[model samples]
Structure formats: structure tokens, C-alpha cells
Target chain A: MRKFFVLLAGMVLFLASSLTFIYVKGENDSVNDLLSANVDALADNESSGGLDANYHRIDSKCEVFVSAGMQIDIFGIGIITAKADGKIAIDGKVVCQSKGNETCRPVECSDLYSVILHGGER
Target chain B: MRKFPYFSFVLSLVVISCVSQTKNEPNVQGISVDINKQADISEFVSSFDGYVCLETYEECLVNEIRKLKMVGDTIYVADDTKITMFSRRDGSYLGKIHKHGRGPGEYITLTDFDVFDSRLYVLSNVDREIIMYNASGDVLRIINTGEGFSNLSVIDEDNIWLYSSDSNDSMYNFILIGPDADVKAKYDKFSKNQSYTIEDITFCGSVSDTLYVSQYYDNIVYSLHYDGYVPLYRFDMNLRNTVSQEELSATPLSELHKTYKYKESFRSIMHIDRNRHTLFAETWCFLDGLALKTCFVKADMVTGKSHFYICGYDVDERFPLFDLSDVIGYDGKVLISYLTAFSAKKHGKKYKIGNLADISEYDNPVIVFHTLNY
Candidate 1:
């Protein structure tokens, strides 16, 4: 009887651990992507000698699906790339998250998607 | 075995809560704020200067929208090529004229322009010259920049802010003169600091003085708040532009979004008619996806909550300020114009004629909104 109860508690803990991993965040999640260009990719064909300016590029990528109501407020501007095998519709007007108010969180976004672009950066 | 039912219910609850965050609707968990644009524009316009003033310009004169200034009944619209004049009484199309130069139509590509009293201040590409035009559309003076300009905005009628786009991108404030423009003050006191690829600079909505600068290289927007050119908010908000494998393989849609990467930030910003309280914003940023993602959003500064309606599809002929303004006027009611019509590049090395015309795609290539009211 003592062995049976101990085994049951162990099983419960294992189930709880697995469930937590699936529910919350893990190692290679979507938000903390680190894939940005640090070196000046602009005017690389030409030497950086003539120029005296310095700037770095930063970007991140995550393939997981960001269900619907999620919103990311990029103050000035930003873009999100969606990755999937099927037709993925991203609402640009999404209410992911805003870094504005701490205690007060605003929620009124129903759409978020992607923007079409032409040509590479010059 | 006896707790099987309880375990099953708990598991379902956890899954449901996690899945609710990715949709257009709030989780029925957080606080919801109502800011419906379809809610009577008349009541909203009543508070701002009697009539709801709009920046109505000729479509042929502008492709990428810049700045719009309204003074009483006179509305001045600036494009990358020319300055358009309009009357606000009934949103009437007044007179249109190009900046004077070698000949009648001789003018450089205009990025920004400001009109004060009888004078129109213009900023051309390469910081070549600062043009001042009289009320009669005659060139009053053309002042060349020794250091050149990247962008230009109005501080007041006489003080014009000039931003450089050279190897070291920085901005300076200058005073407009009759023939020779002079430096009145150094707005930012920029001293050989390089690390920012300044694309375009504009002020925050309703803030009047706070300047928001976009650095595409850093994927950040620097908020330079007003302290008389001292900068208020230099907050860095992380921005990322991504394109998926599926988007790259899509049909004509894929061919579309890969083009607008010419400037630093490949995003276009437009203002929505602000009601008495909330401020509205819309963006047309489709430099990937092949499909255009049109973003329409509204925020209540007081309540700290916002609502967004994002819709995407092909470059429908009628999907922009042009579409919404179509109902605002008559034959020439809500006018749009392009100063220059030339394509830059598409995807690869080759450049195509860019869409410089402010096209009024009036419900042609259709799109279905995902959230809020369309």
C-alpha cells in the first residue's frame, strides 16, 4: 500500500512537469530570437573607409504559431515574418503587447498580419 | 483511476487559456476598451477646429505621403516632387504649382515641404537646396546646404529643421531667409555620432514637439521628446521584419511585398480621423509576404488601451486613404497627386518604376478584415 501511493505521487509530478513545459516558455521559443546583422551591411560593396558613421542591425526569428489575440506594439515601426507550411494569415492590427504603461494595459486590437515589400535594402 | 475525470478537465482548461492569446478578440480575460471608427465621424470632428480638417492633395503629385499642414482655410500638401494647394472650406482643389528652377516644370524630387504665410519651404533630395517660394508660386530663393540634408521638417514659420543623410546621419535646425537660409540653432547638437541610418523623422501625434526617429538598421524607433531641441524620449522599441518560406513562394502576392525595402524602415504610416479622444493610426508595410498587410489601429491615450484591425491581400487598387476618402468628396472631392512616378527596384538588383501614384483602389482586389469593425 505504501509503494502504491508513492508511485502515484511520482506519476503526478511527472505529468505536471511535462504540462508546464508545453504550457509556458521553453528553450528555443519565439520571442528571444537572436538573428540580426551587426556589421554594416549597408554600403558594404563600397568601403566603410569614406564614411564615418556607425550603426548595427538586429533581428530575431521564431517559427511557433502566435495564436490570434497576441499583439506586439513596435513604437515607431517593425515587421513580423510568419513561418508555416499552410496559409498563415497574420493580423497587423494585433494586440500582442505594448511597452507603454506598466500598471495599465490597453486591449483593443483585433487584427495583425504582414506587409508586402519590394527589393532588398540598398 | 478515480481522479481521471478531474485530470482531464484541468488539462483542457490549461490548453484553452494558452490558445486564447493569438486571436483578434481579447481573451474575455483582460479589460476591453471600445473605440469604433464606424461610430459617427460627425461627433468626433466637432471638437477639432469646427470642421474636421483633412490633408487632401492631388494623387498625381505624391506616392509616399509626407507631411500635411493646415492653417485656417489653407491646406498645404507636400510630396516627393511638388507642393499642392487646397482650400478647406469644402475641401476644394485650389491651385497646384511646382517649385521654380531652370524652367517652368524644372524642379528636384521633393521629400518634405512647409508653407508659412506667403512662403513655401521645400527640401529636395541630396540636401541640394532649400527652396523658398512666394505665394504666387515663384522661387524666392534657393539655398544650398554645405553639409547636405537627409530630411526636413518645420519647427515654425521661419525656423526650418534640416537633417543630413550622409555617411553620418544627423539633423540641424536652420532659419529660413529671403535669399540665403541661415542656421538659427542646432536642434540635436549632433557631433559626428554615427550608428543610425536615419530614414525619415516626424513628430509624435498630438505631442506637437516630440520627435520620433526611425533607425531601420537597429530595428528601433528613437523618441526624441521636446526640450527645445534637447530630445525628450529616446526609447528603443524593438522592431523586426520577417518573411516566411510560404510567403516567398506565393503567387503575385510574393512578387509584391519584396519591393518596398528602399528606405530604412519599409513601413508607411497614415493617420486615421481622430475622434474627440482617441488617436488612430494605420500602416501599409508589405515588404515581404508578397501580400500587402494593411494595418488599421486606434489608441486611447487616456485609457492606455488600443484596438487594431489588420487585413492583408494583394495590392488591391482601392485600399488606402484613397479608398476611405473616396466617399468624402465629389468628382474632385478627395484629391490625390504624385510628384514623380518612377520605380526603384523589385526584389533583386534591377529597379522598376515604383508606385508613386496615390492610387485609390476602390474595392477591386478585395480583403477581409480579421478583427474589429472593417
Candidate 2:
């Protein structure tokens, strides 16, 4: 029984170590790939989140409704506001000026054409 | 020695789960996605407007159903075989016109072969030439494209559109055929891009006197407007909303998956959006995707802005399109026909053909608009 226990312990240790090695190797490989792909180096993780404006309009007024508590890539939190009203949530929490688009109100189908968000010029 | 069946239990669970998942999918280069949950407009098509297999005739051994056009009662298909002519009412084979190739009267491979003004025009892969034929399949004449040839479409009896793509890319557009095939019209200026080449040129709507083109490569679809401004619709393939690549890859362990750098960055848009100004698309791709997964996207292309949501079709997970001619759209509908890897059921029984490659198995599917608000 003691011998068996020892063998089991060795097996567990081996698996744990192997898994750790693979995971770390995967992370390194992935990071290298990411760097090679983007001609520009990785910007600071905390770099000012800029809005990659995917949508456009004839005039400047546009509204985006993202799910609450979702992490949005968007930055510039304080000065901007949505056309709709909802719990301003971000990062899985109801946040105040949540610094991202996902924390904003949930957009409804009624807001299809677009809501007149006050300003996103920041 | 506390080990009874603990490791065995966990390992069994993992192996069994992995095997079952692999059984449902195709072995592909890219990732596997939740294709079943993806939007399928097939249910939205009117039953009469959907595909009805020609039960009485032999199926064409064509590799693709390139460029479908419906004129009056006839359904014209430029396929791997002879140009197929069928009756629209019950999918009856009317005739297969024109031998394809470059040797004397033959065409190498037919791409976007069509009939206009009772004249048959074919784009040949063999000759890299355009050959014309009368209705009786006689060689009318291999029109002298004074410049190097690409692909051609009938602009009129005397005018043809010759499109060119990157040399590496099998697709071509910027059609400069007809009387314009000569050097003065600028037909031979195209060269392959070092990093990427033109795959194919899809015909967007011609506004007044100008025509629009869309170029597909990697995951990005560039909207080319030689005469007007066009909106570029980028579908970043790696953008994660609610699901992560870990989650998606975890769902299917039998396959290797990679999340792209962005969502909406890479995708193919062809029959999906016929009009550049309109916001509908039926896109398909094989790799640079999760493998054999095709998507139908609805894009709103108004005010030079494009927004689209895409989902995978052909859940069996095969290459999207090996040749540019794999998918088609006509009259507000799209058709995706390929060899399927999964056993598609017909009358409740699975056919012997498994996966999307067996073009012989199931009927070609059409996407009916579930949302046609515009």
C-alpha cells in the first residue's frame, strides 16, 4: 500500500509538471506569434483605450449598446454617454464611468437606426 | 494508496468526451466553432424558392456551382462539367452547352460562363482565354483579347468585363473584355501583390456608369471602387464577445484552433452582398477560417458604414471554398453546396456520403432571408 501510494504520488507530480511546462511553452509560443504578426510592438496593456470606430454615419451622432458587465476595448469613460438608459456596468460590476463601452446600457431593437449618443469625441 | 479509479475516471471522461466531439467534426487546419448555433437563413427561404434536386436526371460531377443566374424560365450554372442549363420550374436538365477548354474548341475549366443576347460566353481556366459559342455549342470565335486574359462577363454583345486578380490568387475581376480587351483600355496592368494577391473580383452593383468591386483575401474583404467610393467590411475573426478561443477550442478537442488577431478582420463576402449599397452578404471560406466553415452575414452598407454579424454554415466543418466558384446568390437568396463530411439525412436516413465534399449526397442549400427589413 505504501509503495502504491508512492507511485501514485510520482505520477501526479509528473503530470502536474508536464502540464505546467506545456502551458508555459504555449504561452511563450503564442506571445511570439502575436508579436510577429503585428508590425507594431505590443502597446502598453494600460495604454489609453482608444475607440476603433467600426461604425460610421453621415453626421457625427452614433449610439452603441453593449452588454452590461462586459469588458469593452473602448476607452474615454467619463465624458461620454449613451442615448439609452441602463445600469452602467463594466468588468462584471455596475461601475461609475466604467471606462469601456460594455459597461454602458443594453441597446434594444427599438434603437436600430441609431440612438443619438451625446458625444464620443474624447 | 488512495488511487482506486480516480485518474482512470478523469482520463476516461476526457478521452471519451474528446472522441465524441471529434466524431462530429472534420479534421481541419483552423478552429472548430459552434456552427449549429450560428445563424442559418435556410429556414427563411420560401419552400418553392429553395433547392429542389433534379430527381430524374444524373447529377453533374462539377466541383462547384459557380455564378448562378436566372433568366426567365432557365437556370444557368457554370460548373466543373459543361455549362449546365436547367428549367427553373422543376429543376429539369434542359441541356449542357459548350465544351470547355483551350485546345481548338475545348476550354480548360469554365468559370462564370454565361449566356447573353442568345450568345454563350465562357471564362476558361485552360486557355486563360474567353471563348464564345452560339446556342448550338459551336465555337463562335475566341474573341481576341489583345491583352493577357483573366475572366470576362458580358457587358453587352460587343462589350465584356475582364477582371484580373493577383497571379497567386485563382480569382480575377476588373473585367476588361469586349471591344475594351485591347491595350488602350488598360487590361493587362495587374500584377500579384508580394504579400497577397487578388483572389477573385465579385461584381457589386454598378451605380449609373460606375461599377464596384470587392476583394477577398485572408480575413479582410476590401471594397474596391474604381469609379466611386466603397465601404470596407472587415470581419475580425479573433474578436471574442461572450466566448473565448479557449472556450471554443475546448468545445472541440479533436481539432486545432487559433483565435485571429481581431473579429471581423478576415472573411469572404461574395454572393452574400450583391449590391455594394445594400447590407446583405452570403460569405464562405475554407481556411484562414476554422476550416470548411461558411458564413452568411447580413451587413448594412449605408452611409459608407458596414456592420455585420457572421455565423458558420455546413456544420460538418469542411473547407469553405477551394475554388472561387463554390457559392452563389440570386434573387435575394444564397446557395452553399459542397461535399459534406457529416452524414446528412434524407427521408430520415443518413446517406453513405459523409462530409461536404460528397457533392453527390444532399441537395444544395439556400439561405432565405429571415430579416429582410430593408
Candidate 3:
């Protein structure tokens, strides 16, 4: 009788250990999958020229950094920061900058006029 | 098993909450004006008389006219580059206001201009400034209006009304600025949906002291008082067939054409005659889902009668009765100009009242005056 009781307790302990092991393994796999997904998202944000990560606008102060091609318009009496090589139109004039050419300046009127008057030609 | 049921119940509750969140929006009401019948242009316009011919002269030859305003005896004609002044009595070239440069007083692109109390206000899109000039084309003042202003109208010597296409959190559609470019007041009467590509569709004009404002989508015409805007009139445009803002937000922009297959809308109110209680507008809509048609509309505010007329000229017709242009109201009269050498030349003899024969290919447009028949 004593041997049977000891054997029964040992079986119960073994079953509990097996169930705990399965649950722990399943929990670890889920955690690992979540970590991997987060890492991929961070990688994407970095590869996209940090556009989504570093967009900010305060009053008239705006900073936009895009990796791919984009057409952006900045208005109001404010400073604007854009990525180099991006086409930025401020007050209808297109300004294309090179890499690391982030500068905040007010939009100045272009020297060229859109329509030429025939008064001089005539 | 217990956890499974609980999770399923929570998921179903979330779905139900989301489904119930989309409330049914009420349909906006507007005054519907029937535009199915065609009308005779002569019935609306009492007479199409020769007002003032802006003769294409050497000193004032305009390539493309952007805006026109008549202040007293001077006719202010603004092309894309310069604002050329001409005498309204004899079509004599006075002087040209072409400050085209990168200087402090120069402008890159002339978006719009207005004349009030003998002062000409030229709004530059690139410079974002209003170069105020006297009647003789002399620069009186240079008002720096920040940037992105699409149109402007000089209310008085001390004040001017400006319109911007872009709307920020604080500023809305219109802004009232002083002569020093200081923002006196900003009005936010309209909502920005960001659905349409063309944002500068708001038409603003003033009859004496009362300023009128209207948009392409909204049928209500608003009047600016001290600080608020009051609805003066509403046109029933039958916008039921138009696309709703909810649908616009749901559909991807790429698939917009598939969802809203047809686009029907009114153009900006070009001319509003207060004396005759009449307004003129243009309509652009898909015809039979095949081609786009441009139709002209005239509505009488007193009787609520509106007429839609097709713009064209028959070969045998002597005078082409209807041709829509950028119209402006002045002193109880509405003025519409036509390129006599190009479009109006095809319309036979009666339309050739102006100096059409002398007008060259690159000459300025000829002006036509019409009095509203009440």
C-alpha cells in the first residue's frame, strides 16, 4: 500500500511538469514572434528615410524627412526642413535640395514670371 | 473552454460596437433650382451693347488675362505677368504695372488683383505680397501677406480681404488684412474636407460695402458682417447625386473614379448683380456618362427662377448670344470679355462690334457689357 501511494504521487508530479513545460514553451514562442514583428517594423521605419518616425510641426516650424520621392508644400510664416533631393514647393516655387541640405528659409519670389507680356514684343 | 468563450464574447462585443458607431448622417438641405429648360439669352440680358474696347495696343498688349476690374475710368487688366491699365472711355493704353523681378517690390506670379477707391491691389502668388499701386501704375505700398494667398479684394484704403486655398487650425477660408499686412480678423465659415484637387474655388466679391462669398460645393452665398458670416442666399444645386464626404474618405484615392463615376458640380459665381437681383454661374457635369459638358446658369433671386443655357454658336446665327467668361460686376452692370481674334471671330457679323478685325493673334481681349434685365 505504501509503494502504490508513492507511485501515484510521482505520476501526478510528472503530469504537472509536462503540462507546465508545454504552457511555458507556447508562451515563449508567442513572445518571440511579437519581438520579431516589432524589430521588422523598426527596420522598415529606418529604411523609409525616417519619414514616419521624424515628422513634426510646431506653429510655423515644420521638419519633414522623406526617403522616397514626394511633393510637399509648406506655407505660413514658418521655417521648413526637408530632405535633400526631395522636391519641395513653397509658395508655388519648386526647390530641390541635395542630401544633408536641410535649411530653413522663407520662400522668396522667383526671378522668372509665368506669363510673358507681349507689350515689349509688340 | 471557459477562456475561449470569454474571448469570443469580447471579440463579438467589439465588432458590434464598431458596427453601431457608424451613425446615419442627415442629408443637407438646399434650395433646388430646376435647370432643365433652355432660355433665350436676350430675355435675361436686356441688351449686349459695346461697352469699352480694350484695344490691343503696343503699350498694353496682354497675352493672357487673369483678372479684370474697372475702377472709375481706368480698366485694370491683369495677365499672368503684368497688370496693364487702359482708359475705359477710349481704350487708350495708360501704363503697365510689370514689376517682374526678385526685388522687394517685384512679383513672380500675379495670382489676382482688385481695384478699390482708385487704388490697385495686385496679389502675387510667389512673392506672397500685395503690391499696391495708384491709378497711374506707381507703387504706393508693398504689403507682405505671408504666402499662399490665392485671391484678394480691396475693401477700402485701409482694409483688404484675402483668400487662401490652404486652411490651418486657426485660419480658415478668408482673412481680413490691414494696409500694413497685419491680420485684422480671420473667418472660418467653411469646413475643409480635403477631397477636391482644386482648392481655390471660393469666389469672393463685394457690392458696395457688403462682401459676398461662395464656394463651388456649397450652394449658400454668405455675406461678411463685422466678424461673422451670414447666409444671404442659397441655390438649390441638387447635390443628392454628388459623392458624400463619408464615401470619399472610405474609398481609396486610386479607386475614386470607380466609385464616383460621375462628377457634377457648379463653378464659382462669376457675376452677382445686386440691382437686378440676378447671379450668373457655370456648371460642369458628365453628359450621359460619356463627355463633359459646360453649361451656363442664370438665377434670379427675387423669383427663384434659374435658367441653364448651352454655350455655343450656330453657323448661320449673326450674333453668338451666349459665351461665358470671367465676369465682374460694377456699378449695376456686369462686364464679360471675349478673345475677339480667337473664339469670337468664328461667330458671324453681329458679334464683331468690337475692333475685332484689327485685333492680332496675340492681342488683348475685347470687353462686352450687359445690363441685367429685371
Per-candidate TM equals 0.41, 0.47, 0.61
Best by TM-score: 3
Please provide, for model 1 over B185-204, each residue's C-alpha lDDT reduced to its tens digit, 9 standing for 90 to 100.
44433344221222333332
Residues A5-110, candidate 1: write the lDDT tens digits. Answer: 9999999999999989876664445333422232334445346443432222111111112212233322223543332111122222211111111122122223
lDDT of 1 at B188: 35
Model 2 per-residue lDDT tens digits across residues B6-88: 98898999999789756643231222233224443332222322333432334543334545666666666665557766666
True contacts kept of each: 0.07, 0.00, 0.00
> Which candidate model has the greater DockQ, 1 or 3?
1
Error of 3 at B276 (Å): 6.9
lDDT at position B284, candidate 1: 38
Which candidate number maximizes DockQ? Answer: 1
**What DockQ would you assign to candidate 3?**
0.01
For model 1, the stretches where C-alpha displacement exceeds 4 angstroms are: A1-122, B1-70, B78-80, B89-93, B103-107, B166-201, B204-294, B300-304, B311-374
Which lDDT tens digits does candidate 3 get at residues B337-360? 544344333332334655454455
